[model samples]
Target: MTFETDHLGFLLNPLDWQPAWAEQSAEQLDIALEAQDLAIIESLRNFYFEFDLSPPMRPLVKHIKNNFGADIGNSIWLMQRYGESPARTLALLSGLPKPKNCL
Candidate 1:
């Protein structure tokens, strides 16, 4: 499907998010992500599929470190991409639900 930029600048097609869609979402969030960022999205997608849930910050960070390794799993580093609410931003970009209890 053709995606267009929303007011926020990111392209969103929430009903049809695949891992590839993260790039457009990141653009909307007004950040340019590195390869690491894309990898994180892939990991998040895997986590969502396996657990049927989106992860909160700590868990998301931990999962990345555990699964993808230290080169791209630091919470501080992730916070830089989406500010203090990485989980919310990530869920939005990944087209998953905001992590349970996220505000």
Candidate 2:
């Protein structure tokens, strides 16, 4: 399925997001979307709904820590799962806009 994505590959419209789209996006990123990853993606979507913006890494980590727990929330675990730029990757996979400060 083809999605309307921004230059950085985030979905142009958050409402266009779907689980299947996320799976395809993850595949494109070469990261398999497991249940844990899907949970994080749902969290990101919730964050965007609450804050009206994608979060930067620090806040993303903190939010994850708050929601999931320390083991899954640290930068190391995020990096291992999403690579060097977890915030950007998560934003993309979550079908949210890129975090304003991601670049």
Candidate 3:
């Protein structure tokens, strides 16, 4: 995807993202940048609508297990597909902190 900044005006495949910019450019990112994308913070909102609380890593597993009725998926899928750790995902969805371990 391509992004623009009045500062840079246009960014095509720029690297080295900073979290403070999530408010502007985050939703513009695809999966490659999704982990730190501002929108990552919103994913938890969808989860909470179903589960009714912020998710922990383990609870996320259970929620998937109970909801899917199988163990076919796990946390890795969330990370791969959603660019989120359970804690980061929860925080993102809950509008909390970015994961300390996020790169």
Error of 3 at 55 (Å): 1.1
Flag regions of model 1 displaced more than 4 Å. 1-15
Measured by lDDT, the strongest candidate is: 2
User: Which tens-of-lDDT digit does each residue in 12-101 have in candidate 3?
Assistant: 222322354343343433433444333444444456555555566676566565555454237776566556555543444334334345
Q: Which ten residues in a row have the lowest lDDT in candidate 2?
A: 1-10
Clashes of 3: 2
> Of the pair 1 and 2, which is ahead by lDDT?
2
Tens digits of per-residue lDDT, candidate 1, 51-72, equal: 9878998888889889878765
Q: Each prediction's TM-score against the native?
A: 0.74, 0.96, 0.38
Could you tell which candidate, 2 or 3, scores higher by TM-score? 2
Steric clashes per prediction: 2, 0, 2
Give the lowest summed-lDDT range of ten residues in model 1: 5-14
Candidate 3 at 62: error in angstroms?
Answer: 0.8
Backbone clashes in model 2, listed as residue pairs? none
Candidate 3: 10-residue stretch with minimal lDDT? 8-17
Task: Assess candidate 1 and give its TM-score to the true structure.
Answer: 0.74
